[model samples]
Target: MAWNEPGGGNNKGPKDPWGGGDQGPPDLDEALQKLQEKLGGIFGGKSGSGGSGGGGGPAFSAPLLGVLALGAAVVWGLMGFYQIDEQERAVVLRFGKYLETVQPGLQWNPPLVDEVIKVNTTKVRAASFREIMLTQDENIVEVNMSVQYVINDPDKFVLKVRDPEISLQHAAQSALRHVVGDTGMDLVLTEGRAKIASDVQTRLQEYLNLYETGILVSKVNVDDSKPPSQVQAAFDDVIKAREDEERVKNEAQAYANGIVPEARGGAQRQIEEANAYKEQVIANAQGEADRFSKLLAEYRKAPEVTRERLYLDAIQNVYGNTSKVMVDVEGGNNMMYLPLDKLAEQSQQRAVRAPSLDSNTLREITNMVTEQLRRDAAASGSTSRRGGR
Candidate 1:
């Protein structure tokens, strides 16, 4: 049953499947030689030759070695297929020279021929720069700022500069220093922060363009700006003083706005009143002059009669305004005068003191006024009779 079992044969080694004469699990050398010759027949190489030239051990399996090498090559090629993220771009270089850029996706390249560099084109990157800078006002301040950017051209980013990010950092610092240096310290430290940041952004973009850094600046922010620690208190005081100054100026302007209009209105009112007064005075003078001219023309026709009429009219006007009445009788030697204003004043005083008047006192005063009037009338009649004679 067994090839090497001993009992049934007479001077025989073992049963031989290939008609071998002897066997104890066939000779190890002869089996290897047969395998080498068979391999030579298949590949057309001298299979008579072993793996290590002239070796007698079983030839190393050629087909198995070829299978292992093929597996290794497949793995290496698979390793070249890498994935690029949505925010990134893949710049491909072949044989150390520019080839092409790839979009975001799974991509492949020849394992040894191509090199890929992934650049983030949509990710916003930030660089912070801080430096002690001199301001246009000749004061020193610490300016801390940040710049946000993105890679716009991945090829230029990788090939144009040896280290684009480091160059960006330097450019940011230079731009910040230049902007701060051109701005006043008060502005840099306070109200002008946004302006300084904008100026820095513009300058940084220019620098990046000049250097072909392929960076697009998105925004620039002024993080912190301040005077040195030794002068911070003084700067704070100065800031407060400036605020107070601004407040005072605003208040003064408001006051001027309020008072100026009112003053102008008052002045306009005064001017209008003066103009009315001037018009009224001129009209009155013109009317008086015209009346005088008319009266002069009438007087030229009859001199004596007009003179007498004018004298009586003057006396009438004067007497109408007076508190007392006076009569000059042509035939009488004395003038008769009635102090009616004084009598009225006395009556008013009495009425104010007593609130009532006595009827007997009013009767006695009336009798005296009547007697004086009768005597003046008799004298006027006597004068008239003598003139008729």
Candidate 2:
């Protein structure tokens, strides 16, 4: 017989062990009919028993219901388990309210009873802000800066603010402006930049703390701080002037360094020269005093002899080159009318006397006496001959 026939040989085993026939598995209508029949049997209403007595199949299948329950539990358990990385933290919420914070590791929660929001708490986030702010000197300056922050408290990070990143950016801007407003333009552009950045970080941390944003500001760096580009050249000129002032000061210092020692050396030389001159003058004066004192002692010891020697020296010094002639007017008794010129001539003749000798002494000085007498006789004869002629 064919399988499609109602009493076919294929129907010998009671069709399908699970209850429906092999009509390739039961159709939707057939399955619904079977389900209704099972329900009726379960309630003791009717089954294919052909009696009003309500005897039926087993009420509920224990094995198939247990299988469905076990499958749902497996799926729910998988949903409860989560993994957080080293750089992440998990915020668990119970019934839409924050419950506990979980650190990095494998964690579990009741499936539908709790929810986990994973946050990257250790991740460094950066924010940038730029604005025009007034300086301490009332000058407007535009400043650009970047801030690095990290989530320190995941619970506060998730629940405290609407947008933490945006709030951090605004706080950085406010803190930067506050710091810039208290500083001068020169300081902002130069030495105060680091201080300004530090102050901004501090103030930003305070502000974030106030808002409970749980953002820990690690660093703030000022990228650019200056006047507007339109006046950049003018400010550059001012900077150049300051540099020039410093340059001039350094040059003055160099000049003083070069000149001061040279001046000191010149003054020192002058002092040495004056001291040498003083020493020479004192030495000469002492020598002169010693010579004068010796002469005074000699004069005190032999007054007359010293005077005679001094007089002879004076006369010899005065007339050493002159010839002397002496005339004795008193011997002639001038009543005899003596000739003055003749008498002077005779005295000069006598003053130019020849040498004479006694017998024994003459023998000793004979050669000298003979030469002198010859020269004198020749001179006298020449004068008498000249007078007679």
Candidate 3:
């Protein structure tokens, strides 16, 4: 029936699974022999028989040991292999001490002997700060700043500082406070924010370098700079007033820009017109002077004839514009009345209508009138004398 059941089947006391009939306890030596044989087979070594005469029990063969050692070495080497991404760097430490920094890609180092710490070198990490700081003018201002940084040196980042990000945060706060303290409140709350941000970045980088944090401050942004909430309304009113002042100044400047140009243009035009008038008057005066010089030459040649001609020309000019004429007869009781105005008008009208009636014809008619006047004077038995040489 059962393998361990007594009497009926075998006539033996009980069959021991270990060896034969004696079941006091399984033999320790026999158990050790079985375990050795299985292990030897796995390692490609000969197994010893389960007997005392089986030489030195389970001795290791040289070839089997060599294969085992090689397998162990291969497993250790595989454990040392690691891969790093493009944006990452690895810092290797040997025996818990700083060893070397490794670049990205497949890398291998002795496992359990050298420790590898990976850091993302190209990643841009940010730390923001908002704190109340006193300005140089002893005014309170709320400064909100954000610092962006990256791990430039993986070795220093891992070994030099226990916590690089925390160090960077502290450094940023110190730098921001220092910069804000050195600046006036007006600048911190207005256009001066950009300059303050720049200064903070520079100062923060210096601190990181000083601490060997291996962090590069890429950018610093100063967001909203404002007065505290207790005085926000007052600050807004001030800002509005400042803006109004600026707007008024701009309007005045624009008006001046428009009016000044127009005024200058008008002045320039007047100056040019006056110069033209001056040139015209000067040219006319010069021409009159030349005519007078020529007339003077003619007068010097014949004094009486030139003087009589001048007097006749003056009389013709005077009579040309008059509508009525009254001549005093020499040694006569009544004045002589001549319809000279009507005759001059008729002559002027005939000259305008006829092309043949020119200035020469009008001059001949004037000579005929002068001869008639002389006859009339001769009839009066007197000659007319002119005054004012």
Instruction: Give candidate 1's TM-score.
Output: 0.68
lDDT, residue 39, candidate 3: 81
lDDT tens per residue, model 2, 307-372: 897799887876654444232233232222224467558656865794543578746665785577
Residue pairs with colliding backbones in model 3 are: none
The residue pairs that clash in candidate 2, if any, are none
Clashes per candidate, residues 3 or more apart or on different chains? 2, 0, 0
> What C-alpha lDDT, on a 0 to 100 scale, does residue 312 get in candidate 3?
98
TM-score of each: 0.68, 0.59, 0.65
Give one digit per residue, the lDDT tens place, for model 3 in 306-356. 999999999999888777788887656658778866887887797689776
Best by lDDT: 3
Task: Say which prediction, candidate 1 or candidate 2, comes out ahead on TM-score.
Answer: 1
Ranking by lDDT: 3, 1, 2
> Candidate 2: where is the Cα deviation over 4 Å?
1-60, 268-389
Give the per-residue lDDT of model 1 (tens digit) for 184-269: 87788778999988888899999999999899999999999999999989988998999999999999999999999999999999
**Ranked by TM-score, top first:** 1, 3, 2
**Which 10-residue window of candidate 1 scores lowest in summed lDDT?**
51-60
Q: Please list the residue runs of candidate 3 whose C-alpha ends up more than 4 Å from where it truly belongs after superposition.
A: 1-75, 312-389
Report the error of model 3 at residue 90, Å: 1.1
**Of models 1 and 3, which has the larger lDDT?**
3
